[model samples]
Target: MNNTIKILLAEDEPSLGQIVKESLETRNFEVFHVENGEEAYKIYKEEQPAILVLDVMMPKKDGFTLAKEIREENSTIPIIFLTAKSQTKDVLEGFSHGGNDYLKKPFSMEELIVRIHSLLNRVEKIKDVEKIKIGNYTFNYKKQTLELDNISNLLTHREAELLYNLWQQKNEVLDRTFILKKLWGNDDFFNARSMDVFISKLRKKLKKDENIQIVNIRGFGYKLMC
Candidate 1:
């Protein structure tokens, strides 16, 4: 693991937050600790962290709200929720708001470290894949450009993100509703039409590559077959 991985920890409990913050710092993590959700969001913008650990039931904003607000800006930054509320609904709410992992309170330091490492490993893997090769084309995901026949075609932000989403689940059916919600933030009629337009645009862009096809799975979603 690289040294100085940043973590933004939001917990109202001084004892628990300090302990967690100091423990992470011991392992070379740069932690920005805040007592409330409002402050946490402020620090998050100032210092973008590799991961965020948010405790539910904070003063003012609350952890779930914080995660939702952050997700509006960044869809990929990993978030782990620390909450004593272990009900099914609570867990689902956390995930719906863009949390990647959830941990019940009273967790051990060792367990917390393991969860952090696990999430970070997944993030690192995604980060490693800056570019992906499709038949007769090279997609520079980081730069949102598709290169073919020595010509580079720049894609819009939505097009690039949608392509990346499909590519991540290559060869398998990528759910239509999931993609709609993920990329467009809603699966309503207008957004669905917008998604269809984008899909048509992608198909046209990749038409030159005979071996690559973005197949539409009827009533389900689209699949990237290569």
Candidate 2:
């Protein structure tokens, strides 16, 4: 919260976008509002905001496509999908595509503020550790990686960082925001969903060890048990 939190908001609705921009600005967030997916991507590269809010239905590529492209370049930025589509499939698709959170359209600005703050709070809890040994996985914190039996998974930059953060906390619950911030730099819906994808992937990768489990804490976060 001490840092000036920058946001890249991509929405095709001019009035709604403007209102959101103004509301966020009033609460001290620096928001750059754009109308289309292409502009969102361009401004994203230029501004490198701390978080991104994207409308699912937009011109010049949808939010889903934009999120994918952004993930290709930077896998760690927090992303939230704003959409009227409430289908379970759409929500799952958003998560599968690396979204941290998803908000249905006509949401309250106060709720949005709380979500943003919560996400940022989690991101701030991750600190560097010296090393962590999870079953056969040997993680070197400085390198931000996990290696098993001399083989390396060659994780995404943020992926490795998240692993280190989880290891630092060990059996404790790593709040969703903490992992989101450590990996995606925000805890927005898009980023939260994306973290779930990564967590599943990591769990599968480490299935060789029955001694370790990434237990879902049901509504809160995850615990990396040793």
Candidate 3:
């Protein structure tokens, strides 16, 4: 999977796009470069790349719109947004639109390469784990799916990671700071809020089984009592 990783890159600027494509190719990544969001979406539907690098200000569909659409189809694929806007609102909006990471414009190619490698490494780790059993559900780490009876619920990347951690430490109080740092790479306020959102989502998904409960430990973290 190292040399076979496929990346879909969408950038409006011709020179920048070419440079990025070349740089990634030199790193042994298979890249499909497109000039606009419309082409990006079309290629994405056809190829289903492992990761996405989208420029925010595209001609047709726009990066945020493309990311939302792609996310609806595939929740686990990592999305990295490129934009010149550095406002907090814009960054949060990118995350809300299903972006896993954000890169400001005029960024170094080396930085992009490092970010891609880090995300890919994290994904590889998730895929290495075997299926986990929680209450009445079977959690497939690789697929990021929770199956019960004949119904299956697919989880977002963050949801799967958070649930995986809790499942690993079931019946024990897992620290909030530890989870935040492990999952988001930070314990900042915004990331903490994001962690809360994923926790709520996991609880709702696990509610199908009355025997399973994710209890929050006040001033601590959470305990998954199965």
Which 10 residues in a row give candidate 1 its minimum summed lDDT?
182-191
Model 1 steric clash pairs? none
lDDT of 1: 0.84
Per-prediction TM-score to the true structure, in the order listed: 0.59, 0.69, 0.75
In angstroms, the error of model 3 at 132 is 2.6
Error of 2 at 18 (Å): 1.1
Best by TM-score: 3
The list of candidate 1 runs beyond 4 A from truth reads 127-226
Model 3: lDDT equals 0.85
Candidate 3: pairs in clash? none
**Residue-level lDDT tens digits of model 3 in 1-226:** 3557899999999999999999999998899999999999999988888899999999988999999888887777888889999776787678767787878889999989988887778776655567789998999977778999979887766677778889889999989999877656568887777677678878899998999999989889999999
Query: If ranked by lDDT, best first, what sequence of candidates would result?
Result: 3, 1, 2
Error of 2 at 76 (Å): 3.0
Native-structure RMSD, model 3: 3.6
